[model samples]
Target: MTSPATPTGSTVPTGAESADAIVVGAGHNGLVAANLLADAGWEVLVLEATESPGGAVRSAQVTAPGYLSDLYSSFYPLGYASPVLAGLDLDRYGLHWTNSPDVLAHLLPDGRAAVINRDLDTTAASLEKFAPGDGDRWRHAYADWREVSGPMLETITRPFPPVRGGVELLRRLRVGGALRLARRLVVPVRKLGDELFEGEGGPALLAGCALHTDLSPEEAGSGVYGWLLAMLGQEVGWPVPVGGAQKITDALVARLTERGGRILYGARVDRVLTARGRAMGVRTAGGGLWRARRAVLADVPAPALFLDLVGPDALPPRLVEDLAHFKWDGSTLKVDWALSAPVPWTNREVATAGTVHLGADLNGLTSYAGALARGEVPRDPFLLVGQMSVADPSHSPPGTESLWSYTHLPFRPNWRAEDLTGHVERMEEVLEAAAPGFRSLIVGRHVAGPADLENGDPSLVGGALGGGTAAAYQQLFLRPVPGLGRPDTPVDRLYLASASAHPGGGVHGAPGANAARAALARDRALTGGLYAGVIGAAHRAVYR
Candidate 1:
């Protein structure tokens, strides 16, 4: 197979093509995998179903021609802190991060705001307003987080079983301290907050962070996520690319192309071509057969990779049955607005934040989440709002704002077109309650529900962000259905490189990095065959 240059100057396969690795999906994870493989001198090819890259990490002028709105994810604390992304040195490829004066603001029902600032003293002071000594408690919690943050991040980002990282964590915290921390992490966010905070401010901040996932404040293990994100914000302010989220994608693509990796857009992979229980290549919907000599990495959801692409016949019966129970996170409904002016918040502190959590107090969040779990939409939805222009001024014209807010919805809601419109109106009302005259400032508005999001990026799988549920039952080794908790799948030479893998969700790029490392490890001259033999045996034992 010969490579030919496309009109856009990217190399594409002229006929049947073979590469050392074929990555299905041009999402950030897939692109990360391609970049790593290309850096190792492999002929890497990425096939994307859409016309562009960056799946959910994309931005566009959806509201208006001049205004830039993040089509999906906006703020990126994980991207800034991720060792995997840092290793890529994306800034060298024109990625610049920008942050607002504050990291986040959670506006209470009474118009009091709990804001998180980069400065410890300022954040503590903000919390102190609610309860006298709550500030000191926050300080103590933050200090504890700092002690274990290094090893904790390493453990979470690295492949599961986290041997080296786990050992390092034990060394850092000691046995008793580690067990205590584990106990805290296992409880519900509500309980964790109640135990740690005397006032509503601290608990509100933590609960708001927990809502980022599908888990409600009452769910066990929600505390860990909430605490992790809150700590990350204090450590590294939630930031956006200077221009837009697309800049992050552009940086990855630039680095990959520089390394001679090729990405073919509009190539929807229809099947994982396997023979003798080994994945050898992929067939696209357009009838293009691309072969992979070393590996095929899928930056797609577990169900799509296993059931749709690989087919049930090729999968073990147990594996197939487990997939039937694979749970997706809540569907999302997002609204983007081109505002004529910045939001006129009741509390000035809310204006300083790049991100805001609105329409919820601590208990409100619980009720909203409960509604979703019961397959019903909350009348007063809890919103995760982004002020893109506040984070990056280039997102909109001077004095104006590129704003977006998203709320969780039931996985399958029986709603008509009018019902969705009514939800949008309700969202606007909630915004208006927090930021008076907010609706008046909107110059344009665009709404994206589950179907629309799925159309834009099939990997989103019904607008369910984070790839899959972040529930305790589906996390860690149980992710994408148990087994080795690594990238290796039941099919040989295939890897799951999406958020469906371990260390689920957030834009950390760990899953992609892990997959790349696995592929490279199994392709090494001396240890390659040995590594493959062991991994293959483990899969056979588990899947059998």
Candidate 2:
């Protein structure tokens, strides 16, 4: 399985057999890291186990020939706003985006809907219908978002212990406002809603966004995610790739290949080969070894990288113990449909929105998340729906529509096919209640349960979407582990470049960008030493 090495440590020239850096898994982040390194003149090689790249950010026409459904992810607000992608100008590489007139809608039990529009005033006015004076509260909250949005996003995406982001936030908010913002960050979404507005729409909208992760509306630190994502919709509309989600990944792969980087499909990395406690390269499942002269960036989940590939024996005992406590997020059940007609919503506002949240108000949302936390399947599950045709007409034939909906479930170590079918039926009933005769329009359908998703992409371990739980104990500095939140690993030349790392999931390439910056810095001996020392000191301070 090993490649021939010369006396001078040169490769035997097996065509992409050697590179300055090797990226495992051709996910968006992996490809992003590869492109960055290749742009820097490093001979980068990317390995993908599947027949294609784009681990989760891919599309399929499972329902019908003309229907393009985003198999995993669809919206790209984060991708559009990503600083790394912005610098790359992926538009030139064929990543055109399309946005709906309205961003999202939260449909209530009574058929009224709360719509989030790109215009702040319009969104505020919509909230006014639920309660008097709520429009002002909405505007006030948006003003706070304006103050901290830049700094908050920078802190999330940048390297850990964001000193620069802290300074900028403090400068913008001043001491009092900054302190208030800090307090809000720790409050539960439920409490945040109560403090801000006295209306169902205000609270329901926030809770709906919080459910995007595995967190309950009552969980501490859930408010931040809810606020952040909702504000992102305001700042940058939840845009979809013109053709499909695959366009984003396709563009990334194109840029990488154009920069002379190579991608090897069907190369499943079986193990990460190490020498003297440093990553050397990877061995594929097909008994072929590729060498990396500088670094190996693993864009797979942390458990897959550490437990399965690297093995517990190779990790420090403390890290191995910590890995045991690693918590996965909730499992998912997704249903994609090729409809003969658009969803006939009871509320007209719902028809205009690209995304919809169904079968939940504030209390229901909390209860649904709480049920998952208690390892129980929710009787009335919360649904996240994507109207592909409404967002971008290219998703299906004219007048026809492509739609998908998904809901979270507690992790069942051994989920069965019958269980998924039952859940799908329950979801159908929920949708039918909201949109009468909804099921009649379905010309074709495809269902992906937890096992199906995991089989398709192991990164969604047990179908936990955000790489892991976004609970207070498992987010930010403690994400993946209690280690410093950078991509650098205890193993030299090995970096964690997956969504399982800091900032945890979404289409943002921050984890990959952070890993590449670390590797790039390491290539410079003096800068590497200094950066390593600083990171080590920070790690000690936190862990001590």
Candidate 3:
């Protein structure tokens, strides 16, 4: 671990360092790894290329100075449900979230809207209004979810060499708990919804919620994706940080440092340095070499870490081929709007709800997903708009509201700078369809196309927020490619501790925590004393 030394300036340089563990990036995963290792009495150093630590967990006045917008993920049910973070005690570090009563409201193309409230009974009751028996189905689904989500999260998300969750799941299958869950897993959300519910917009609306994270309800992996989102909505209600998403990162940073770790911003690590197939350390962009005496946990992308940093010669042939065949989700176009006032929704329910899902129904979601497969962008897009100032007033000055919305571009927009006006204009037209006169609400707007996101952060990979695709083919055991699902990379002592690993994305520190445990185990057994002595001397050298 190479922490910042020399109070004002750094001797164990940001781009260059020599420590026990040299972490490459300062994204949430990178930060999480640094915090965990530091707590374990290891010398840990973190390097972030961005000005801020959070990769997508940023809240800035992107549109106008006063209107604070959550840059990437806005509503976070996953953040609240994260076991890694739940263990961190971050409230003392300055992270607090406020949840509105109604978690989401989907304004249908027709004037009607389906509002999902925090209370399951109320949400079920609301569904009953849509259809007499749909309410019971909703409750039944939640009960089923309560059963499997634990097992699913355990097997899919637990730390490395994960056997317990897998063993338990296999045991359940042997007994018969797997039949219904297996059926749910195989059937697409479209099929699942058809069998379960009777409603005009309620089923489709719930599917829309599932589609929020860029999943297609028609796809195979999408059944679990859809059910989990719906279940979590009823179980935990979507939450946004009280101030902004940055508060979450701030809280994490505080706890990490308080645990005797060090953080450095504007530090860029170029490559993972290895000696005889074992991970040693890293080389920074500025030509400084930081060698790790024990382990190196990398928070960079898989391709960047494997191909660019460690080099192809160091990896197995099958792994290289898999990396080549590894798929990335299509590019995205995100827009942050600084509204002069609240957006006027046609269905008034969304005017107060935390999130608004606007787009076509189940069929439309499949069409959009299919369109991306054909490399065509959707004219009528699926948009999720989050009203920050609606639930939290401090996001903007008194009375005014802050709204940020996003829709994927499916095919990367290959247009010039002058062409952005057309893209933003098209996005506004899509918004105006659900929220009448949405153009009038726009006081200031900031546009970030696929290139902009990649420019801002390269790991975003065409601005696909979940690292790569969250589809069935690229999820769980197959994430970032098969066989190396847990955070361990091809290089010894170097772990891929990012969203690209299993149980992917959404501000959860599972990947980081998983990687840290792996590193800690490795560090404690064979190289613990050697790394401690070297890194401790490195820290004390500058301190004296």
Q: Pick the candidate with the highest lDDT.
A: 1
Error of 2 at 491 (Å): 0.2
Tell me how far candidate 1 lies from the true structure as C-alpha RMSD in angstroms.
Answer: 4.7
Write down the lDDT of every candidate, Cα atoms only.
Answer: 0.89, 0.86, 0.74
Question: Can you list the residue pairs that collide in candidate 3?
Answer: 1-20, 1-21, 1-43, 1-44, 2-45, 17-290
In candidate 1, clashing pairs total 0
Residue-wise lDDT of candidate 3 within 450-501, one digit each (tens)? Answer: 7888767767877777767777777766778876466766556788888888
Backbone N/Cα/C clashes per model: 0, 0, 6
Return the clash pairs for model 2, or none. none
Q: Arrange candidates by TM-score, highest first: which order?
A: 1, 2, 3
Query: Stretches of candidate 1 above 4 Å error?
Result: 1-15, 413-415
Candidate 2, residues 1-544, lDDT tens digits: the string is 1222312122223454788999999999898899889888999999888888999999989999899999999998888887777878899999999899899999998888988999988999899999999999989888889878777878878888888989999999899988998998889999998998888998888888888988889899889878877888988989999999999999999999999999999899978877666777888886688888889999998988887777666667777778788888889999999999999887889998999999988878878887888998899978999999999999999998899999999976569888788889999999999989899999999999988887787688788788888887877778789988788886677899999899888998988998998899877866877866675566556544
Overall local distance difference test of candidate 1: 0.89
Model 3 lDDT, full chain set = 0.74
What TM-score does model 2 achieve against the real structure?
Answer: 0.95
Q: Model 3, residue 361: displacement in angstroms?
A: 1.5
Q: Single out the weakest 10-residue window by summed lDDT for candidate 1.
A: 1-10
